[model samples]
Target: MIQKLKDKGINVIAIEGNHDRLFDFEDLSWLDHLKRENLLILLRPSVRDGKIFFDEWDGERGGMIKMGNLRFYGIGYQGVNNSEYVERLGELLDPSFENVVIVHSAIGGSSMGLMPGFSKIEEFIPLSKKCEYVAAGHAHEKKIYEIEGTKIFIPGAPEYWDLSENGEKGFFIYDTEDKTYTFIESKKRKKIERKIMLQNGSEGEFSAAFSMAVDENPVEKDSIYSITIEVPYGVFCNVNLAGVEQKLEELGALKGRVVTKWIGQDSNLPDSSDDLDIERQIISADPSLGNYAPEISKAIDKLKDLHRSGDTDQSSMVIDDLLDQIIGEDGI
Candidate 1:
């Protein structure tokens, strides 16, 4: 894609993220290959004797690139919380032109609570004061924050890394003249979520509710889905969430997740501290795994029966298949 862009006479400038570095070797990075090939321009700053200096590349001097009235500055992953780096970068900024600082760092006040060890947006107050726009990366959610006259632009990830990352996944195109940025949404894979709450704990009730939810909607092909079933603790053992996932897969879902939530704890149940009985202890140990108690119990019963019959070959096959079915190819 970089080659294609280069062919079109378009300049591709990129900053390194944490994953782009080969940490084992000093001053080495995965992006070195691209830089060597001249497919793209690398503009990340370098530190020598505690002093920051930009790598001169593509006829551009310093860490600054000039195109018309806009100046682009790139900084890679250098622990944003590091006061030294942030302070030095502020010293490099030229307030004469429309400046855009593209840095891969977490930038937000409340984000510090959600992403510990990340630099607070306040840390970049100096840089934000000098630049017109601070384009940030590393976080997977799209957000914009204005500090003084500068705006922080986070375009978010181009694709959903997991079900939890639910939002418009894409990049941004900033208009230098207008001082406005427009989000360009990517044609990434869609994520769908379906949740069901059950009042009755019976197997019949569970199956009927699941079937109705599935039948009511036409599952999109090649789309990811999350199916959440909330049931009373007593009835959780009787319901089969795995079956619901299987049905969704059969209906052309690229992938499916079946999350079983056991609600309303039973007073008669054993305490989680009781390790004497493995089956009972498992249910009491973690509420998240409690929904699997019935399936685990059934599997255990079948294995015991096979053990008594001395069917070693059949037992091995059953165990292997069961493990594969439950764990999947990726092992959870």
Candidate 2:
């Protein structure tokens, strides 16, 4: 694909998603290879504050490239909203010449999910309107929209396919001279959907349901597939999750790749149990806070012990001492 784009005399930029850093180690390792070969420009996400750092690329995001009467302004995935960086991009845009903005990360999916909020695009759109078109990737579905008169294009994933059955996998080509965009969709790929229900039944019945679900949705040996199962809670209580996983593997229904998730009510709950509600509240809260609350509570308990052991008094004398310190009435 890189060679094909190059043959068309178009500059190709490759952007990395968070997932690419994981299972796709070879691509991450080949960053320098692309740079050396001059085949494509590679942009990677920066780590900062538990999210991709957008500010690190403020002064060093993209460079200017001249293509015929068009001036392509490249922006990395970072610093899309910084005022100074946006102003810098604005300065690069010339009214006399057509402009194209090439970006790796657009405002969707991983970029949107990982970022704190959705305000960067607002800051970028105004400056981007000065350009003829904006080409972006990272979104797994192709999309084109006009924001503030700027044509925003997301070509979607090139070869990476989505597990969702409805996902569109494709690429885009923009003719700089004619200001036209073309989307090329991949060949039709086979998709399979499997649903299994394991109600109050014997072990053999449950096993047969699982087997039939797999058989009914056999995946093409070469096609990508996804499986979603809705199992009532406690169905797996006596049954081994690992054993079920092995059974699915034996069925060979996932074409070597399988992603399974469970969704259902906690049918295993007792009618008089209070544990579920309290546990649910803690589980639903912010994960970071949930992790720290127990430690904070433990510290408070220790402080209470100190006070109860006569290390500190909670009466008029203590209040008087505190007031004296506040007024600087006590000696330092």
For this target, which candidate reaches the highest TM-score against the unseen true structure?
Answer: 1
Clashes of each: 0, 1
What lDDT tens digits, residue by residue, belong to model 2 across residues 1-332? 67787889977655433333333243344444665677776544343454332222232232555557876665443322433444566765677788766665545322112221112466565565588777765455677766687877876664444354365667677777676777788765465556555565345755776667666776455554444444444444234455665555555534433333334446444545343333443344655444434333433333333232222322344345444543453243
Write down the worst ten-residue block by lDDT for model 2.
Answer: 109-118
TM-score attained by model 1: 0.70
lDDT of 1 by residue, 127-196 (tens): 7668877888766668777766667888877877555466666889887768777899877777778877
Q: Give the number of colliding residue pairs in candidate 1.
A: 0
C-alpha TM-score for every candidate: 0.70, 0.60
Clash pairs (backbone) in predicted model 2: 54-79
**Model 1: residues with Cα > 4 Å off, grouped in runs:** 58-63, 80-83, 109-117, 200-204, 232-243, 262-332
| Model 1: how far residue 67 lies from native, Å | 3.4
